[model samples]
Target: MSRPERWIRLRGKPRGPRAFRRDLAETAPGLGAGDLTALLAADGDEILGWGLYHPSSQVAWRELRRGPEPPDEEWVRAAARAAAERRRRSPEIDERLCRVVHAEGDDLPALVVDRYGDLLAVELFSTAALPLARLALPELHEALGTRHHRLALDAAAARAEGEAAWVETSPGCPELVQVEEDGIRFEIDLRRGHKTGFFLDQRENRARLRRQVAAVEEAEVLDVCCYSGGFALAAAAAGAAAVTAVDLDEEALAMARRNANLNRSRSIRFVQADAFGYLRTLAANGRSFDFVVLDPPKFVPSRRERERGLARYHDLNKLALPLVRPGGLLLTCSCSGLLSALEFQERVRQAARRAGRTARLERLTGAGPDHPVRLDFPEGAYLKALWLRIT
Candidate 1:
């Protein structure tokens, strides 16, 4: 069936960075609340694009489809199927745990789907996508060959939209599921865990760490902010002599311990403490590691927090650099979309200088290919990792 073309007008010429939010001159009167609407220029009735109108949000409208053509159910289904096919074609992705859809990367805004074995976790970022997501679920199921799925809503977005945090579409779906990646097993609880149960974005990075650790016999490793022991277990399985995983969340530490036991990674030690304080104590005790990974949560969520967030990143790296022995490896990362890759690299350089160490950048990377970024949407490429060697 053809979708209805509900139209709304924009204030000025749409000549700027492509963003979810578009400035409005005026909206069509009597438009249904939160319905998908066609975006038109103020001068004429010509349809500019398609967007979701939410009067309550600061971004009154979120553009969904760009250009004249409006999107329909078939369009949404095709996008979802294409996203799934891309993952299937990528040899780097482990089918059991991979991102099935990366929202805007797939040209489907505000919708993300991650596959964990038979379970599919769907996250809706905008209210407009909620209806479209409902239409795409069956298509997603057919494309991914998974009937079991759950809607994992962002807590903040849920509150903003006046909806529940999470909802299960299928009955008898388990709270937790076991999945494997690169020969390592993990237990993921989609309902309670962060970002659809596991950090699938770091899958490749962890594999890289494993390979690097395997090259160094008896490598002592430290994983800061090690949620659920991804890097810790990877290093341990790679035959690291000792791996310490530190995080502030006790629950995460418990899960990390369980993951360690599940993988029989006895070399990892789980510690629940503030990463900064722990790093300070390690430095004071003159303790050092052959490899250190600093993967903190999003320090800069928005542009307003960039200045303070950069300072925090600088301070954290300053403390972390000293904990890496001479000739040792340091893998630091920032998930903040507001911090550019160049800015993050410069901060790390300053940190290295303050630590009185000369560092060589071995590699600069980001999330796995599963989390693909659209060239036009740089914000999608939020994860920045710098692999350095300190001397």
Candidate 2:
């Protein structure tokens, strides 16, 4: 992207550049970029940074780099190497599978890097991340020592640019690449799954759930929307007496079944059904569980859908809470970045009240250490999880 450097003045952002989509809703002074190319070359007078400049995107100019020194090929190489080295050394992160670069969290915005066995599945969340990816991927590949690189673009972000949603430039990933992350064995199809194939973000949470399951005797664990059986398999691995995993997607259930088989977990009963309907049926049949996990997909992707999404969460949790036996544990989660921790907890509190259950809030966790968040980018702190106990 050989484009002319544009100089712009930004104010009120003492922490860093405003890059998140949520920032767009604020009446805060907005900065517009020229339609020169996908990759942006710009100067904040003193700050020299490179970002993705999109005309139609929610955050049109999403800055990826910001520093006193101008970012270049060599600079990106060093940054990528450092980011990879950090993950490699983190005890919390599994070398077999982990997030090396968490966009802005790693001081590299717009770009995302995930490791899947011998290959690195690199995806640009938006075309805005492309400029940095172009400069960083080759260097990142060398740092990670991967056999191959699988490049993919975010379809939703691409569509905003009036481009095809699914765009891949590299070779397909190995089928069912097995990853033993955080002491749990998961066989995943990097080419077929969502967000670099597996939910590496839930690594530590799953491990925590496994330990919790182990502490209880004959724990009847219920995993809702058990995609590929991440949580269900974890519970089963911990020797839970009975584990019930449910999902609406047949393909996901099929994968979950395969994962159960791979883990040699025969205790889990896999069911393909609507999550709400299944929860309702479980409650109707008077079935209760020692531990229940509610990890649904993103409901509030943007500010416009905030209230509607919150209602969905409230309804889902209201139905699921009753199935949580008295004194049992419940883990509810929301991937919607727009829903703050306070907002999520309040919704759960409301749900518990509506369900006529006295729930004690035990913990509020988030994506594992692998998915780090920058202090300024509260939006980066997307995943909100609540650990509660029915009293």
Candidate 3:
């Protein structure tokens, strides 16, 4: 009948420690004993993921995947292969730089697979997904036809899961390779450069930026926090007269230079500098552009840092708005999960006001459709983009 009713429908009891009974109250507090039992059963189809649930924590599951049949090597390989196939069809995605297996998106929880050129990067966010990663590696290699595989275990996800910390021997590919999106190529490392190498979730936003770039006739463009030049390349391709791409990462700036060249856009100038410093420099120089892009990384990681992050965002736009000529465009974004969309916009408005610049909101967008957000789970909606016109 209804979506919520259909989703709640379950059958039978799940097999686990008797402690699971005790955990029900603490784990999924709102769910009744019967509802928890039905969740475990899965109507006899077998669950791909299960375990001690922690509804309170951002990570809600201890058992990533389980089934009627043992989830062994074959199953792991098949799952990895299936996930890769799904990403292969997306024209916007560079197969080399993508989320081959996006945890819940691929029906595999606590697992993330990123493809960087010839290398494959794997990160396990939960204990249940670790063994599956080892089992699935060979299959991932076979499916993608790449031997270079690197496992990144730097984050604290392991500690939270009560698992001993283990150093990852492999770091996916050796040298970074070029990943092209919308005629823009970026060199991405399997070992570093944000989540699983590159921000693949910003595919649609980059495309939208490109379209706006194409409409402007010889517009001067500024791309702040120009990680690997995704937005810069798009603007350059759209024929921006002078595109200045700024980033603190030397490696990323080098990649951005290559990306500019790949698109045969000589009009772009790559600058290696802190985004905030660069904005201040622009303001001091009294330089203004027809288009300004502020796509910084996550400023706030948790709720505690939200106010500081919001303040940073406000100050960033305050400096950036003055660098945008009146009647020009400002594309601002926030990838912080800690901040909500309304709060981000309010911060931008505050920034515009502080800069003595009035603006009209043109558009409000989020992560691409591929990175779908479940109606019940707002955490999935992380990226927020706003297009504004300086008045």
**Candidate number with greatest lDDT:** 1
> Candidate 2 clashing pairs?
52-128, 103-108
Task: Report the C-alpha lDDT of model 3 over 1-391, residue by residue, as the tens digit.
Answer: 1112111212334332222223332222363211221133334323333332332234444333444233445666787788776667777555766667766555555667777666777777655566667867777778777777767653666565455645464644364656667656676764456666677877888888888888988889999998878888888778888999998988778767766677777888888888888888888888999999999888887667877888899989998999988899999999886688898999999988888999899999987644645443455578899999997
Question: Candidate 2: where is the Cα deviation over 4 Å?
Answer: 1-5, 8-16, 19-50, 67-69, 169-173
* TM match of model 1 to true structure: 0.93
Q: lDDT for model 3, please.
A: 0.69
Residues 6-107 of candidate 1: C-alpha lDDT, one tens digit per residue: 666666776422323346666667766457787776788777778677655444566668877877778878887888888888888776688888887887
Taking all chains together, each candidate's TM-score versus the true structure is: 0.93, 0.89, 0.75
RMSD, model 3, all Cα superposed?
7.2
Local distance difference test values of all predictions, in order: 0.83, 0.77, 0.69
Question: Model 1: which residue pairs collide?
Answer: 11-25
Please rank every candidate by TM-score, starting with the best: 1, 2, 3
> What residue pairs are clashing in model 3?
48-65, 48-66, 49-65, 149-172, 150-170, 150-171, 150-172
Give me the displacement of residue 296 in model 2, in angstroms: 0.1
